[model samples]
Target: MNNMSVELNYGYNGAIQPYNKQFKSNFSGFNHFEVGIRYMFSEHLGAKIIYKSDKFVNDPGGNIGIQYNSLGAGVVYNIGKKIGLTYLTRDNLGLLFHLEGSVGFANSLIQQYESEKTKIIGIGITPQYRINNKIAITTDFTYNINLKQLYGFDGFPINTTKISETGSFYNLSIGLIYYIGENKYHSDWY
Candidate 1:
């Protein structure tokens, strides 16, 4: 059986703030979009790989916006059937909850001067309502940490630069999930 799904997510992404003044500045009002593929191994366990794009501006009414791209893999823990819960609003309508953790890389542009790349770690909670056996609506809230290190300057009189820090961001997403299997989960014997 094909226990797979594809999803598209859209939501708000927090601004990227630099740790030091020597680095680039901060910007707000960012937007996010993501696409992913999920493989469900069981009724309560799944894995997902996703790619996300974030749009941000330098200042208010800025002409051009920077695009940040991130790719990650996460584990999903399903909690609907485990708690003996099923439909919520109507017949064939089911409510489900999931917890997820992920790790990946984020590539960002810090103006035309230099590029910034960071390792990202995130945790999220998703609540979904199944519209039918093949489709569902889901919303997720994820918190992400960006980790990077800056090296010291190469050579000078007595000059050196040292940089190593972690930044953070949060995302709230709403999306549709489409299933590609006859059942939500596969049998152990299969």
Candidate 2:
């Protein structure tokens, strides 16, 4: 069985902290996109690779924005019947929980900074509804934490002391998914 699936998604991304009220900064609406490939090694366990791009912007009259690019690999935990089995069974509709840790590089146009490596940890949940044997609609809610120090305009430090500081964001997305070499195998369909 080919236990592989690929997904393409687009959504809104924004920062949850350090909003810089003074500048009234925020994020560009619908400014994030992601591509992920998931391989189910076992029935209830697997791994996935993801790449995401996020762009932040300020409100009208504000002059601060940042862009984040990240690549992550993480463990995938499937939730459904055959939960304890090593071989995964496809369900027409199912839920998945994922936790991932990643290290990526960032660049800031406001501060004239080059590529700087940063660490991040993310946790998210995905709910999928199959449309047929190979197509489905999926929604994901994810939160990410930046583990390295963050800087703002003029090269000023925003979050100092690296891991000690708090720099985080959240994403809410909905997209379509296509499964390869698989059929709707949910218990409900049988």
Candidate 3:
């Protein structure tokens, strides 16, 4: 058996921001991409770090966007032969649960200001189901606290607000895993 598998993932989050009386308008969109990678480890216990670029476009007047570069590490321990327990750790722990205090960064464009940086910190949760050796489904729920104000025009100072701006989104994804090599068996285990 091969110890490693590679995956190609594609999915979309329906609407990011709802229509509000306080804000300008509603934000809704779809993100699509094709990424390639190499995975190393076993299904019972493994870790993977991926790099992906995502592009988002909003409606009304603001074309707010971001380019995220992240590193994630995760482990899977088989409860029996078909059931498993999994945990993933990263700087952007938005897939864990709604909470406070975490560290992450992104370059954002709000309204017409395209040269601003925003720092995000929060906690989140993700639940995943392994359908078989070749497929799995995962859902992520995250709440993010934005450290910087929306770009374009600034009326307030950096330290004016006691609490940062909060944003949350959920994603459902289906992934296909492909084995790329041979598995190494330990004599101690057999």
TM-score of each: 0.72, 0.80, 0.49
Runs of candidate 2 exceeding 4 Å displacement: 61-63, 82-90, 152-156, 159-164, 182-190
lDDT of 1 by residue, 39-87 (tens): 8787667788888876654455543334557777878766554554442
lDDT of 3 by residue, 1-190 (tens): 5555555555553334322324443333345332334332443344444433334345554455443333333343332222312323211111112233323334454433333344444343444454444433445433444454332112122233433354443334444445454434211011
Q: lDDT per model, in order?
A: 0.58, 0.69, 0.37
Question: Best to worst by lDDT, what's the order?
Answer: 2, 1, 3
Model 3 whole-model lDDT (C-alpha atoms): 0.37
Error of 2 at 167 (Å): 1.1
Of candidates 2 and 1, the better by TM-score: 2
Residue-level error in angstroms, candidate 3, position 31: 0.8
**lDDT digits (tens) for residues 89-121 of candidate 2:** 344566777898877566665655555667889
Candidate 1's TM-score:
0.72
Which run of 10 residues does model 1 get worst, by summed lDDT? 151-160
Superposed by TM-score, candidate 2 places the C-alpha of residue 91 at a distance from the truth, in angstroms, of: 3.9
